[model samples]
Target: MTTITRRTVEYPADGLTMVGHLALPSGHDRRPAVLLGPEGTGISDLQRRRADALAELGYVAFAFDIHGGRWFSDPEEMLARCLPLLADPDRLREIGTAARDVVLAEDRTDPERIAAIGYGTGGAVALELGRAGVPLQAIGTINGLITGRPGEAAHIRCPVWAGVGSEDPIQPAAQRDAFAAEMQGAGVDWRLTIYGGAGHAFHHPLDELPDQVLLPGVGYHEKHAARAWRDVLGLLGECLPSSN
Candidate 1:
């Protein structure tokens, strides 16, 4: 039987209480914890499902909400809510730090084995956390963009795995190549997997229109989504130690 628990945490930052979902693996001691960041839509059912799936894999997972528990169906609203925080570097750091602390505070979580994974805007936060010298075992970003320039790449101290879709217009091939070069030049352990036919939010089937962000001739591919998911799980297992 798989054990999973869900609870809300109030992250007191900047005088606001940001609610988050914490999922723990039952019958485990000091398991590695993963900080799960939501996409631009905040903490949706999909994010919660991901956390539960991680818990089933024997990981304590925290799906942290940067959007203060609000959900929006409109793309414009999602962008409006997420863009301001992404634009402000300081707030972004504060929120990330707060979420990291929340996961670390759990007794069942292994302090030294914490990793972070995010999608889209949340992916930027995960990358920023690693770049800001946060003590993380690994960082994974899916269909996300890097906010700052490439100069800060030297500060990353852990392995990074980035999954991007070839059809993702938000992240152009040239930019991804530049980012990979920067990571390599900084001597950072990094790997980037580009899905040849996938578009943005490839893993998220719940999106009203997954192919809406597709280019004039590009669209999402299901095969790439499966491949990316497998790669992410393998990378996380490699970076984070098992409780057993």
Candidate 2:
């Protein structure tokens, strides 16, 4: 295994002090980078581990934070904070851009070769970045099929891959179709994968979370989670291969 360095980075975003996790491969040379976004509950060890895993693959990865540095264990609180943020594209772009800038500031990052992968609310943020015309090599989202404003998708220059549970009530078929229509109309290279028998947040692990934190129609599917990770890796490998 390659040695990697990990650190906590602090920055200001959305009227709060944001704390993000940064992981870098063991080398002084610049490498492709990924901006990782977490679920609405905020940053967790799961996201940090993902950053480390990306670093092992020879890419700098930064797990960006939402909800400041606080993890919302209360379902209502989480929804209250995330729902509004999801509805506002400008706000989402502000936050996602903040994280992107932080990763770009790192000496190990190849600014021209960065991508974004986000889950749930984080996925929406990644989409927002693409919609805002941020220069990204690729965009991948799991259980976050949120669409953007009219004609905004035309600004996305990178290929997009989204994965979601077929039975996800939070993002039903209508929403998925709308997202597809938007991407198609904008001529963006995009694809969607529907995992059968899974529900919202299927890619998110719930074992370490509190019982009360499980929102309605949300459950983790271990098989699909692993599959989603593989799919994400494939997307990254295809769109932003490591220089090493």
State the C-alpha lDDT per candidate.
0.79, 0.93
Candidate 1, residue 18: CA error in Å? 1.8
lDDT of 2 by residue, 1-244 (tens): 9999999999999999999999999979999999999988899999999999999999999999988998988989999999999999999999999999999899988889999999999999999999999999999999889999999999999999999999899999999999999999999999999999999988767776855467778998999989999999999999999855
After superposing candidate 2, which stretches have Cα over 4 Å from the reference?
Answer: none
- Those runs of model 1 whose alpha carbons end farther than 4 Å from true positions after fitting are 147-150, 207-220
Sliding window of 10 residues with minimal summed lDDT for model 1: 211-220
Error in Å for residue 241 of model 1: 3.2
lDDT of 1 by residue, 1-244 (tens): 5867888898875347788889988884789989888777677777888888888888999888877777666667777777787777667778788999999899998888889999877788888888788899999988776745566778889999999888777788887987788788888899898888777777766454442343232344668867877887887889985543
lDDT of 2 at 94: 94
